[model samples]
Target: MLNSNLLRKLDMQDLMVFIAVYQQSSVTGVSEALFVSQSTVSYCLKKLRTSFEDDLFINTRTGMRPTHKACTMYAHVLKILESINLCHAGPATFDPTRQAVTFNICAPEYFEHLILPRLLKNFDFADLPVIVNMHKLETDIPADELRDGSLDLVICFGPNFHRSHPDFKSQVLVEDDLVCVFDKRATPLEPRFSLQAFVERRHVFPTPWTSTTNMVDGWLARQAYKRQIVARANSYSAALKMITGTDFILTLPRRIQKLLAKDTIFNHCEAPNGLPGFTLNMQWSQNSDPDSANTWLRDQVLKACAEQGLS
Candidate 1:
């Protein structure tokens, strides 16, 4: 059997006063401990006794003594107080080494290839594993994913990207320009190719991952030029492989060119005719803007970029 009316009258403050009186053995003692006046403690104690329908404490020759009911309720009240304290304390500090946190980052294949190795090499994930799920950037910003917490962050090129989502926060992670790559064995022995020679070569161009328009072609179109495309590949790796043992040349980001050319025999030079460069930026939902774990993840990325000289 429960007392509904008594439940309404009882509150956290009442419980605190009763607990303080029980522990301190006197209202005046409770007042001194809690830095409240003796009258305030008495008022709350009176309410608590009315709520319980019991003389919760009685004055004795030595001190105030808790009744049987008060003694029975003391443990429950202490637990409730501890829970209340926890609730008001805010979120705990994030410890990556102690807590497992998975970070979801979206990027194009090129950005993934360039950043993943560097990020893993620099981050010290010794105790607890930090998982990173990398997804390819799409033609449109995944606003629903960002809002709903399905995705944690995105890194991609295009300054105008994510402009539609005002709640999305973004920072430039790296800047890179376009460069032309071709097999050193097949390319003409020249310091640099003229714009005419650049356009004349059979090009192995990479198709954009999520868009129909080729970014390289779009850039060339703005300058009233077009390349003789021999084939189109879906990713930078595919495009890089297609040009191997052939005269076909691939135009790609300078950083990506350097990374892919590490093992492969390739010659690279600045793209002819002053091709446009792009900046890759990292974006996260403002919903996580104040989250400590997300902030640490972003910092790790910035550190990786710095180590790679991309920042």
Candidate 2:
């Protein structure tokens, strides 16, 4: 039971008014930013209130305060407004030789280390303005940033994260099996590792921030097995450094092992339990600017994965 006519009446201008007011928390601030009279901004607010059938903002001693309803509505409204802007702006004349853009990615540093070097070598972003910001991937609320437009894309371990968000699209870029890495010189036994042998050895595991553990831990729980984690670290790099020249073994992605093959200190060890391989996905929100630039960026990521023999 939705009123199509009522929804159609709501436009981008009204959304802009709402966003400006929400950010600045005052009609005067919005007026200053939009270069309009205070009355004009107030008028737009009134229209939005009527459209939403709620008092979206309240006059306070300090400035203006948003109602709980307004706070919740702002996120969706902002996303919709951004999508509309992208659609109208159309594709940019993306000249990598001179164009400038900032791309934000949410992923682990290990992922960046494996893919960024070769990826950057192919693109000439010297004259063109470019900025790449890497964000740590969170286990909880995977696609929240992408939906809110804070993140352009997410490189996550699996498809489970995007199943609920139908507006997002994903492509599997690489499949990686889990492998144990140990120093070749420190390894005492044969090349093959048994489940008993794995459990008997001291292991290095990336510690979860809270009670919630990682996928490997979950897999271990299913088998009714747990490792005696002698060393814990927040990142794979830290874990790798900790295990080098030590007797501790670390579970790592095969792609990472392949990338680090040149390093004489590390060698792959067999996992007898046959841990499940994970798929690395390249995901973007449907709300993203469907411009040529966005398309080119996605293509570049895919090409880089293929070049690294990860595809």
Q: What is the C-alpha lDDT profile of model 2 across 166-252, one tens digit per residue?
A: 777888888767788887766756676787787788989864222256667667788898878898888677888888888888888
User: What is candidate 1's local distance difference test score?
Assistant: 0.80
Q: Of the candidates shown, which would achieve the greatest lDDT relative to the real structure?
A: 1
lDDT of candidates 1 onward, in order: 0.80, 0.75
Off by over 4 Å in 2: 1-93, 125-127, 159-164, 207-211, 261-263
**Per-prediction TM-score:** 0.72, 0.64
Against the true structure, candidate 1 reaches a TM-score of: 0.72
Model 1 clash pairs are: none
Please report how far candidate 1 places residue 84 from its true position, in Å.
Answer: 12
